[model samples]
Target chain A: MKHNFGAGPCILPQEVFKQASHGVLNFNNTGLSILEISHRAPEFVAVMDEAISLVKELLNVPEGYSVLFLQGGASLQFAMTAYNLLPEDKKAVFLETGVWAKKAFAEANLIGNAEVIASSKDKNYSYIPKDYTVNADSAYFHCTSNNTIYGTQMHSFPQTPVGKVCDMSSDIFSRVINVADFDLIYAGAQKNIGPAGATVVIVKDEILGKSGRKIPSMLDYQKQIDAVSMYNTPPVFSVYTAMLNLRWLKAKGGVAEIEKENNEKAKALYAEIDRNPLFKGTAAVEDRSKMSVCFVMENPDLEKPFLKFAEEKGCVGIKGHRSVGGFRASLYNALPITSVHALVEAMQEFAEKNV
Target chain B: MKHNFGAGPCILPQEVFKQASHGVLNFNNTGLSILEISHRAPEFVAVMDEAISLVKELLNVPEGYSVLFLQGGASLQFAMTAYNLLPEDKKAVFLETGVWAKKAFAEANLIGNAEVIASSKDKNYSYIPKDYTVNADSAYFHCTSNNTIYGTQMHSFPQTPVGKVCDMSSDIFSRVINVADFDLIYAGAQKNIGPAGATVVIVKDEILGKSGRKIPSMLDYQKQIDAVSMYNTPPVFSVYTAMLNLRWLKAKGGVAEIEKENNEKAKALYAEIDRNPLFKGTAAVEDRSKMSVCFVMENPDLEKPFLKFAEEKGCVGIKGHRSVGGFRASLYNALPITSVHALVEAMQEFAEKNV
Candidate 1:
């Protein structure tokens, strides 16, 4: 009866959860918990191998791309991407759209010279910047595909003269994109994929080993690619859960079919928010995130009652972020239409009662 | 019936796995997968808070110490610890015991000036270096509590004139230790705790803020400690499983009782290895790791058949690392006495036939 709409570490398919739970107990009928298995074992290696292959298959990634399941989440990638890609005297360009982008900028600044090509920070990051010029000889153009807290998304990708890398932590696999356009894409699996602890990095093989800096073995993308993501002990349980989630994604007719469902769900919720007088949407209409619908009520006092009512009606995690107080309904890929409908009904009832 | 002795991303308790699996499906009866919940949510905050509290209580950690559940395994800590604790001007003293300690030393060398106080590398790291001089004004003295690959342990901790830090990745909570002795302690949860993806960091509050170097938020132990390990999205499932494992440890009379059991298991396995003429123990008698027992046959060519026979007899993951070839029986906390008995029986049979 309950719906989960919390942002990243957001909703995952029920079947994925069920299968993942089963694996923890008896992984491939090994009588050992998935935690107990060796990453080097043929069984676990197969799991990593298939997980990477499926990621490539689902995204239509080209042959040269190598997928790595790393520890430390996408936040680590903020440092790693810059550390591996940014050359000694050159700088990287970053488009700051939201909290994640800002974090990436800070990490890049720490390691090497980074220029903010454009930023929506002046407007509290309510919209993604448009038509920013990327340096032709720069290391890469970094962007965040979706902003979870700000409820903003890049409607279209930036035209990068150099290699393009994205922190798709929040919006990976929600829709199809031209995989060829990106040289690197990293996502923390807590959002649309599986659990925390694993971050997926799909990097073009050729773009690696160009960084003159002596990268640590763990931080080196090329080292990880050569070992096939088993350079160090990988997050085995998380990877397995991701595989199950990917299986669920594939079963529901892949990204194209899921995109339709996602669009429909977002449309239903956004329609309710736009029509409702008591509530006001937070992000710019042109750049609003389909995955996360952020809004606030007219009366600040009504926020508590609205959230309480929503919770009582089995609509959970509707409260917005503290920085931008309101309500955010995260309609991730696994969030069913029924849940979105339930949220819409709650919003309507709240609007009528308050008005 | 399969035994998992793979060093890290290692074995976990069956009951812990059961409870964790259930939590992933319906965390705290909220009808949401643990993956779906917000990290800032009161429910998850409570989970992390309790996990930290349990760590303190179980280890009898002092009041000044803060516990953090971070991503990036113990490997990351090598760089982070050096970056956080060491100033650019002063050298950090390192005690190189095995492959892990060597890695730690290498990472420290990359970041700042580090002095190798003593190293067992000359002796192939068979034993711990003893009677080493401590650098008085060094940033901190670093050592590995248990060497996973070489199967060696620092039975008695070194007396450091400077602050002490230990990478307790392999043998954390295996025995009672004076937590106050070290300024910091870090362990990758894969081995003894629950699963991969989460690393446990215990740091004294007073020892921080010394390094003038600007550390990236993720690498800064102080930032993690300040946010109470919520600086970034933590490895939720791993932390929850660790909580379950800690509860299991508590129910079984805490570390004291577990240590006794561990010692007995190690004794049984080591005795068999010593008595068997066909097999030779890899580590020194006094420095042997209670967690991992490395051994090799008189005829190294017999390794394949020995491993096959062991696998057939339900002794799995016994093959040693390629760097240090042979067999290793990783007797982690969750490894049952029955499993060790089974391994010993297999080894005896192999010795009888092969010799």
Candidate 2:
């Protein structure tokens, strides 16, 4: 058994993978390849509808919110959210926690007025920014809930008077959050949902159409919501695979149980990083990510050897983001505690040998 | 052994489906699911490179052109093309053949100046508009090669001095076209290529960057081309499946051989439709699409019973689009001639029973 620790598109339940494979070959015993079936067919429609409804049910989304499964990933959403929400006169507020947050801010700037309310760039984004003030007149207060590169997560949400928009790309569904806390939440499904093709958007219905600019039909949130995410032929196979993942998520006791197990895995790994003399955690202790556990070797010389050692121990995708070097052990919801234990054991062995 | 005639997200080669399904379960014997692998992984990178190369080879894309696999389907491309190509002062010309064409024109109108130079809407889009002037000052002359809903197609080309753009979503690889004739070509990979999650774009490198507006980063052609379609995590599974289909296409004697087969399939079905006393072809004779062949019953009362009988006889997804309110038999590239013969037999038996 190999341990997968890469950030997004990292790990998923084997059951989900199996079911999705079955779907691709013979969807519902229809003898028609799922890849060949129409997206508007009753079966595909059911898949789309069930996927959307399960998202709502899993999140316990409030009634006023609309859930959308869209293409172009969260990167498309970075521009779409700003284009649809930011008006000409009103500026958007952003909290820059890491690389993705900075990119999100830049995308918003491209569309219209956007201001970085706070940033942790000075300290290399090792922690979430805590002192940002949200402008009452701003279109929305945008923030990245989890920094995938730096391995820091926002444990406390900022109390914003204006609309709150969160890019929960890496940490969505790993933990439960109050659905009413944010005006909008977007996540790239490759992380915690299913695959790379689908993006999930949870938007409060009232927050849209205020922007005066004519939105591209595909980028319009209201248009997608009105059509119930079938505004066009949706990414069918991706959505179907995502539905299988969602079914798996629900079967495993939903987000609350998964969140508990997630903490256990993270705690075991972080405990090892803290105790081992040869390694150190990268993120600030208080803001360490429960999802992606970033760390580095205390003796820089041992880095390559430790990585090779880990690879020999059946650990895969443990390398950190190129922007931030060393190692990153992403403990997503589907990554079992046994994998974390295995990684921890490898780390301990490496430290004992090196130090 | 089912006959699939749905317009899009339609038939794909059975071999492609099998290989893709296997990849989903165990990609390249890595012991990790394809859905869980990183987009930047060497395996996935190979998948991307091979897919791009195959698309280039299949289309005979010139050296100066870039082939991009993008998300958001053709609907997004409708806006992206105009946003990238249409300058602020110069108008774009469009041939409005059907519903999709009208929508494409409207998307361009939202971005900049767009003129519908010709339209077949006067005749319920039963025929392709032939008489159209491509103004010399226009930025580009846009056309849809095949009208999926209205069952019409352009049998002749308008040789414009300006840039030429075509959305070949429904009938791209069914026939051979001179790649040099168009500045850009785009197709949603559902019908003729692969599944519904990916779109293929072939753009001449010289036609971009003329528009003054700051194109949305995701929609910017230059950025996408520069990044080699890896600017973000693409729809990995979709693109991989599409690559498998492309390989299948190449293995089946490429576009030239497929075109002959497609014509034969279309001819057989159209002949049956024309000869049946209960049926009548919907599209004009010269403009009928070889990919999507639509027909209606001469006796309207027989429509429901005929459809029911066809469905019972191992025919699946043959329903007509709601807008056209008639049976549509889409014979895309991967649709076997046997399926066409089955459909023809169904129509003949139904005609004998009813008439």
Candidate 3:
């Protein structure tokens, strides 16, 4: 079997894929493909409802927060967070983490005044910036919880005076966090949730309607939540498959259990990276992400050769992003520990060849 | 055995569903689910490219026009159209024919000066408003090509003094149209295109980059086109399935052929509605949608029984919209003429009982 280690829109449990594939043919045996069913139909509506409810249950979302399944990935969320939460006169504060973080800040600044209080870009974002303080006057404190490119993750969020907004796109369900800790947590469903279409947003009800801008109905969080996340015909199959995937997650004992698996997967891969003579981890040891385990061969010229070696062993998508220039094995929740073991073995076999 | 007449996220070719289902489990036999592949991966990039190329070919989209597969459906396009086209000072005019038209004009007005140059709301949208002059000073004139709620359509578009924009949400790809006639033509894929998660936007390149407002990247057509519609991670399966559906359309001899079939389906059903003594057509005869055929019973109390009757005979989703208070049988492209014949037979049977 091919071990898929591609970043976001990566691996999902095979059972979920089977169910989703079956759904595309005959959903709920209604003799209708999920792709063709009306969102208003009771069958699909129940799927949407379950998708939303599962997010709340899986995260233990508190009473005052609302969970939304929306279109437009984290890219759109970058601007939407500013439009709904940042007023014309307000300054939105940000932690500059990686390319996504930079883009998030740039988009927010395009709509309103956005300031970066701290950055790890000086060292190619190998670690999280921890020294600077968020301004109390800022509209909101925005941060990217995980940098997929550099494989850095903020293990703990900073407490801020204003609202806290985090883009948890790459690492959302891999670990558990207190829902009430942040004012908003948005994740593109691709990585840990389900697929690439639906984006999951959990927001505190009270933080909305404060932007004072006449936001479009599609971009306004309050209106979307008011419509009960059926704001527009949501990504139907995405939501349905997401529900199926979440059901799988629930059956596998939710985030805590998945987090344990994710840790072991990352530990096994990183341990090999550290122990192997030809390789080394890329990110700062403390801030390295559990979701995306990025590393490089010590001998730069050997990188391409090792990539081919890994591919021959059916270790797919092990090549690193161009920006990072090494390797990124995304240990997402759905990737089995066996895949990590396989990657580790390949690395060991390759190291023996080189040494 | 089932005839689906649901307005949107409606019927698509059964073979397309089969292919789409296969793609989900083992996309191109890559041993990976379609949901797990990276949008940037070569295999998926090919899928995205083919999806765009198919739109251009099927629509005969000339040079200087960009075809985009975007998320957020037509609702977001309502605002995006104005955001990218309507200047702060210039007015955007609209022909308000139905609820969708009214919402489109309303959304445009929210961003800039907008006016409804004509409206059919006075008659409960029973007809398309034909008499109105679009101001030469208006930035662009917008119209809904098909009204799903009221079952009204603009068979022939108005020649506007300025740029012409159309929301062809419900009836795109059912018939052929000159892409040069409109500056922008957008449709939610659910009805006739593919599925709910993706929207198709065909825009003339010359009409862009003049709005003067700093539109956000996701809503800005120029930016999206520049990015080749990969502005964000697209709705993967929706676009993939859309490609398959479009391929089906092409193999069935393209839009001209489908238009003939669509015309025949509308003709057969409308003839039955007019001939049946117990029922009558809802929209004006000249303006009745060839896609959504709406009719009401002569005796209103029998509506529920007729719906029940239709469903019992394996005719599904024939229930009309709440506001219309009648039956709306949407004859989207994927719906076979045989299904129409089946529905007509049911209507005839129901009329005999009522009489």
Task: Give one digit per residue, the lDDT tens place, for model 1 in A47-128.
Answer: 8888988898899998888888998888889989988999879999999988889899889889889989899998988988
DockQ of each: 0.69, 0.83, 0.85
* Backbone clashes counted, model 1: 0
Relative to the unseen true structure, what is the C-alpha lDDT of residue A48 in candidate 2, on a scale of 0 to 100?
Answer: 90
Clashing pairs in 2: none
TM-score of each: 0.95, 0.99, 0.99
Q: Please provide, for model 3 over A139-253, each residue's C-alpha lDDT reduced to its tens digit, 9 standing for 90 to 100.
A: 9999999999999999998878888899999999889999898999999999989988999999999998888887889999998998888878889999998999999999999
lDDT of each: 0.88, 0.89, 0.92
Grade the docking of candidate 1.
Answer: medium
| Error in Å for residue A282 of model 1 | 2.1
For model 3, name the residue pairs that clash.
Answer: none
Assess the local accuracy of residue A65 in candidate 2 as a C-alpha lDDT between 0 and 100: 94
TM-score of chain A as modeled in candidate 3: 0.99
Off by over 4 Å in 1: A135-138, B299-305, B349-355
Q: Best to worst by DockQ, what's the order?
A: 3, 2, 1
- Give the clash count for each candidate: 0, 0, 0
Per-residue lDDT over A72-109 for candidate 2, one digit per residue giving the tens place of the 0 to 100 score: 98889999998899999999988988888988999999
Worst ten in a row by lDDT for model 1 chain B:
B1-10
